[model samples]
Target: MTLQTTSAERVRTSFDKQGMLRAIGATLTDVRPGSVTIELRPGPSNRQQHGYVHAGAVSAIADTAAGYAAQTLMPEGRTVLTTEFKINLLAPAVGDRLVATGEVIKAGRTLTVAQSKVYALSGENQRLIALLSATLIAVDHVED
Candidate 1:
């Protein structure tokens, strides 16, 4: 298999181990070098009292997307974890589904900076609902 294909597969494998994402119904939609996208359907389980997608759900997907984006660039023995992140909720996430797209801004030997933009999609309209900036660190994989 090509390196790119292998890289995406690695991400998918790691993402499958995330219980929070599965609990909130998040799915990996696209995975590429330095970029990844996650999708979540806004339902009663994930919505706030206002009938909009909860901010925590939005943050979780964005954080995971950004963390996985950084992981895509690491070597086989390394894994990435979020060290810090800041999220801005620009608009209410009231839609059919939420899409978070993350891309690496700067990748260093130990730390990688990534950003995720979350959009709420309703019918034919898509609105930018949140923006997240995250820092991730590459560390040796721990035995499971």
Candidate 2:
């Protein structure tokens, strides 16, 4: 398979293991060498007052996308963990779905920095809802 295909598959497989991502109805939509996209439909449990997507759900998807973006660049047998993150909720997350696009800012042997921009999608329009900056660490994976 091509690198893009392999990367996408790897990210999707790892993303499937995330309970919170699944709970919030987020799915891995795209993956490349240094970028990934996650999409979510805000369900009843994902909303806060005013029937908007909660900040926690918004940040969770963004953070998870960032980690997967970094993971795409790591060597085999390696995975990523978020060390720190900062998210800015630019607008109310009120739409049919939310899409978080994550891109690697810098990739290093042990640490990586990435950013994710979350957008609320309605019909043919998408609005910026949140921005997330994250730092992640590469670690060896041990399968059980």
Provide the overall lDDT of each model, using Cα atoms, as 2-decimal numbers.
Answer: 0.92, 0.90
Worst 10 residues of 2 by lDDT: 1-10
As a TM-score, model 1 comes out at 0.96
Q: 1-144 in candidate 2: lDDT tens per residue?
A: 587677778788778788888887888888888989999998887999889999999999899889888988988888888999999999999998999999999999999999999999999999999999999998898572
The worst-scoring run of ten residues by lDDT in candidate 1 lies at 135-144
Candidate 1 local lDDT, 5-121, one digit each (tens): 888998998888889899889999999999999999988778889988899999999999999899889888889889999999999888888999999999998999999999999
Which stretches of model 2 miss by more than 4 angstroms?
Answer: none
RMSD of each: 1.0, 1.4
Candidate 1 residue-pair clash tally: 0
TM-scores of all predicted structures:
0.96, 0.93
Could you tell me the TM-score of candidate 2? 0.93
